[model samples]
Target: MTEQLLSIHELTKSIGSIMPVKGISFELKRGGCTALLGPNGAGKTTTLRMLAGLIPPTRGEIRYGSGDGHTDSWRHRIGYLPQYPKFYSWMSGMEYLSFSAKLSGLSGKEALRRSREVIEMVGLQQAAKRRISGYSGGMKQRLGIAQALVHEPELIMLDEPVSALDPIGRREVMDLLDRLRGEVTVLFSTHVLHDAEEICDDMILMVDGEIAEKGALSELRTKYRQPVLSIDVEPGEREVAWLDSLANRPYVQEIELGKRGAKLMVTDMGVARAALIQELADAEIQLLRFEAGTSTLEDMFMKVVGS
Candidate 1:
């Protein structure tokens, strides 16, 4: 029970000429849920696997707890679920959890008891007896979580846990993770910024296999926060051209264009707003929608990655 559950220092993973994770470093707090935020191929999975002892890093160290930073003797304290968790299609959920429990060093009786308990904790009790082949995608993900938790590890690391699931399935897993927060120090990787913002107080943002930003969610939000204007016009050549011209406006800092709309990052919201409205009126462009708001967490994510 140290306050720091884990600390990664100058962690580097190199493969020949390609470096998947380059000198990344961060710390995870005890009993805190942290999101490894990044897009595809950002080395998120690699980082998680390395931390989970699936692979050794090319350079750097991972210190578990406040101990002497020993690498060995820390596996039992961790639980991991990969993005695509594999399981025997014929095995029932209960069987899989029990097997995993035993693999984690629990005795037969302990394994069974833990399996039953975790099955109920993840809301898989109803489907615990059913074959894996018959369970839905969401149920299977829950079972994967159950297996991970069966050993009652101190920290759980999940790699892109919800990326493969449908909306409903994703919500189910997210909700479960939210509930598990504070109970177990959770570290989950996800490219979806909104998901991280929703449940995690801390985040490690990655881009191109390197750390882009890492901090408490509130701090990062304020650090990247800015005035934003989202505008949508009817899909027509004239309207599209009008939107394109706004990119060169003096007050606009950046612009992300979409099919029917564009989100503009502005230095001065009031000036840009009045000018943009005048330009639209003068051109008689068909305005479909308009909004004034601050940069969202997703916007900040894109900006950091892009930077």
Candidate 2:
């Protein structure tokens, strides 16, 4: 069985009397990607800061299962990249990474070696000698990741790593994240739903200082399976009324009133489709089109959050 990388129990953090993260609890397993998702000022940053040990929790416990102080240890095996990364203007990218490696307890030679490898890993080898001041937003973020990863950390937590990036830059960062899939356990925080939909194996959705939902994306979809069938019809009140009556049908779950037509969610969609089609044909309502709508992450988010 795989080892547990991170575990938090009733973790809470308050900023000058304002509760930022109130009772957040979850566990991160080794070698998988988990995303912390929420809207603006939703305690994501505070949560990550606590996990990185930058600030002690105001209440409750955050247990780092693997990283403990020891020589030749796993404490050095954790990497953390903050949302807005800052670096000394005078230090070149390679120098910054080498410094990080040294801080992780590598020898001078080993630090240099790891720095070189990480620079290339983050695709900064060509600009390795360039001062950090000359780097772009994307470049600096990548450098932050390179520095964090220089020690070959097993667990990595990045706080909004793609917040300060363009579409192309975000794609590059996402690609780098994908490359780290099987190699490291990643816990990243972001407000972007599409990003989570793209790379997250599991998600922890926080709302107003608490976890509103948590589970695998697939599992959540399964639990709240609302299969929809989109129907297009000729303009007629009779057809609309006929479709609306489906709301009371035993197999039909619900009907979403649309501009042109409507969507029907039901169990055993095949039977539902046949019955609805037969009813429509019997009513002489011209059927323009029909298709099934699978629930998406966006749909799930709106449903869960009621927005």
Candidate 3:
């Protein structure tokens, strides 16, 4: 078993009078990507900030590597990138990265080297010397990621990194994050379910200041209904009638027929699937093709939150 890098016990946070995070607790593994997903005002950012030590929890305890038998300090291994990173407009991209490195305790020569490395890592080397004021939104975001990783932190928190990016820019940043998969532990918050589904190994869905569900993607999928199987056979009246009859089955939630064969909303495939295949075989129906379909992450989000 791998060691835990960060642990929270009954962690809670409140703002003056209102509770924003209510007794949330979970463990983050030493090297894994865990995405925090929620709708707007779901306390995703607040939780990330609290865990990053930017804002202390109002109650409960957070320990880093206390029982892991490690010697290095945890703070030096944690990096945080907020939704919007502030940089000096007068400074060049290279200068900004170098400044960030210095603040993270890098020496002058080390800062310069790390700065160059990160600038290139974010694919900003060509524009490294360009003033930040002239940079585009995507460019700024890449620079933000560079600064966050400048300290060589083992655990990084990215709060809505792709929220402000366009499709292309989002893909770029997501690809960069994908490259860091095994090397670091990432706890990123995002409302984009597709992004989370694409990049996360595990996820925690938060709603109303609490965790609605947490687990590996496959585990969650299995816990819920098996994926809906959408089949489009060759168009024919016999096929349509056959599919329509299947709608009466308890496992088949809904069925629709058109120029395509049929679309089924099946709740369980473990038993219904074998029965379906057998039914088709018995009827001597020529099966064009069949596949298992799945509800999107958005569907899962709504289901989990009961919204």
Q: Pick the candidate with the highest lDDT.
A: 1
Per-candidate TM-scores read 0.83, 0.82, 0.77
Better of 1 and 2 by lDDT: 1
lDDT of model 2 at residue 276? 80
Model 1 C-alpha lDDT per residue in residues 149-227, reported as the tens digit of each score: 8889999998888888999999999999999999999999998888998899999989998998899999988877899
Off by over 4 Å in 3: 66-73, 227-297
Candidate 3, position 46, lDDT: 88
Tens-digit per-residue lDDT, 1-307, candidate 2? 7687778889998889699999989988888899999887779999988777778788887666665432224457678998878798799999999988998889999999999998899899999999999988788888988887888988898999998799888888999998988788899999877888789898999888899889888887687666788888876887677666768888777777765677777787888888887887788887888898676667767755654
Query: Model 3, range 4-72, lDDT digits (tens) per residue?
Result: 888877888999888889998888888889999888888898888877777878888777864743223
Question: Candidate 2 vs candidate 3: which has greater TM-score?
Answer: 2
Go through the candidates in order and give the C-alpha RMSD of each one to the true structure.
Answer: 3.7, 3.6, 5.7
Candidate 1 residue-wise lDDT at 244: 84
User: What lDDT score goes with residue 131 in model 2?
Assistant: 95
Off by over 4 Å in 2: 16-18, 66-76, 102-110, 217-226, 232-245, 281-289
The 10-residue segment with the lowest total lDDT in model 2: 66-75
Ten-residue stretch with the least lDDT total in model 3: 66-75
